[model samples]
Target: MTDAIRVTGLTKRFGARTVVDAVDLRVPEGRIMGFLGPNGSGKTTTIRMLCGLLTVDGGEGTVLGLDIRTAAAAIKRQAGYMTQRFSLYEDMTVGENLDFAARVQSVPGRRARVAEALDRMGLGGRRDQLAGHLSGGWKQRLALAATILHKPRLLLLDEPTAGVDPQARREFWDRIHGFAAEGMTVLVSTHYMDEAERCHAIAYIAYGKLLAAGSVAEVTAAAGLAAADVSGGDPELVRRIKALPSVETATAMGAQVHVAGADAAALAADLDRLAAEGLSWRPAPANLEDVFIHLMARRPDPAEAAR
Candidate 1:
């Protein structure tokens, strides 16, 4: 498949601080690529640059085949952007808000387009409801409806499911998949691991750098980390496991401790010794969260590194 977005040496700076540093990214047409990163890690900055919402300090790329540097207006016209907040006017009714959006985008057949957005987003019955009166889920649905009112080919969603309940988030993702099935390309930034796993692939960013990118299995495997699940009643065991030279991270989840390390042989040896202490040791597949934490730990703080 062809790439909807292809960029290299994408860099952004604020004053003396480089917020996004020499990042390279590609999103294939008709695919969903999750943008994962911790707070202040430049995920938002990168998304803005991709959609042409923000100017790039250094980079060369195309979004939807339009030059990112020179064709920002054209790029913005074809791309749908949903900000982290509910950007629609709250006092306006659902239908009114969509109508306003349609008008703002200068959508042809504005009335019909607004109606279609309402029906498509399942907000038809609630069209008369005030935007402020809607719940978090409904607000999200409304935001999405407004976003697609202009029929953008590419969607840039920034933390689209933040603060939403699980069921609502699931429904939102279902709609997103429906859009992708219809050939819409999506690049969504999110912090939820479950949401990250739902994407066709994920790009992990840290300290303004692109650390990892690939399918879930590929990224995890590329981390070169081995993990083991230990179940025991002894809390002291968890502490000891964390201090081991072989273990990179030890996380306690209920009665089991999930330990991981980059060196498989060394981690296995450490587990073997711990197993002698009557703890149950079982090999566990490395998860996305584990790989992310490991990557974050390995990278230095961008500020400190700059100094």
Candidate 2:
């Protein structure tokens, strides 16, 4: 597939502080790339730069084949952005909000487009419902409908499913995958691990830095971490595992203690000793969340680095 987004050394600064440091990213056409990071970690800043909502303080790139620096207007025209918060007119009905969005974008065949968007989002029956009265799920669907009313080729979603229910988040992801199948590229920032796993690929940023980017399996494998799930372990045993030099992290997931480490042999040896003490241990694959947590822990605080 052709590249839909290709940028290198992308940087954005505010006064002396750089919110988004030199970063590189690429997303193939018709693919969904999850952007993962802690709050204030430059994920939103990078998204703004990608869609031309903010000017790049340094570096260069092309979004939807348009120069991010020189053709921001063109990029903006072809990109649909959904913010974390709902930004539609609360007083308007669902249909009205979509209609207004289409008009604002100067979309042709406004009525047909609005109807299509409504039906596509399963909001045709709720077209007359007031935006302010809709539940979080319905409101999200309406926002998504408004976003796609313009038929943008590139979609930039920033924490789009934050407050929605699990089922709503699932439905939202299904819609996102449908869009990618239709050849629309998507870049979405999210904090949910399940949502991150839904993407074709993921990019993790922290403290203004792009730390990792790859498929879930690829990222986890690249961490070179080994893990084990231990059952029937007492709380004190869990603490001992956490304090081990070979263990990078030991998290309790229900009845099992999920432990991970960079030194596979040493970690296995430690687990073996624990197993001798009565814990039932089984090898486990390191998950994306584990790798991400390890990455975050390894990186120093931005303020400390500055000092």
* Top of the candidates by lDDT: 1
lDDT tens readout by residue for model 2, 1-307: 6888999999999999999999999999999999999899999899999888889999998999899999998988899999888999999999889988999899999999999999899999999989999999999999999999888999999999999999999989999999999999999999999999999999999999999999998899999889999899566767888988899888988888999988999998988887788878889999887898889889988798878
lDDT of each: 0.92, 0.91
Clashing pairs in 2: none
| Weakest ten-residue segment in model 2 by summed lDDT | 232-241
* Model 1, residue pairs in steric clash: none
Candidate 1 lDDT over 10-101, as tens digits, reads 99999988999999999999999999999999999998998887899998999999999999999988999999989999999999999988
Quote the lDDT for 212 in model 1: 98
Q: Candidate 1, after superposition: displacement of residue 294 in Å? A: 1.0
What are the runs in model 1 whose C-alpha is more than 4 Å off?
A: 304-307
- The Cα error of candidate 2 at residue 157, in Å, is 0.6
Candidate 2: list runs displaced more than 4 Å: 304-307
After superposition on all CA atoms, what RMSD does each candidate show versus the true structure? 1.3, 1.3
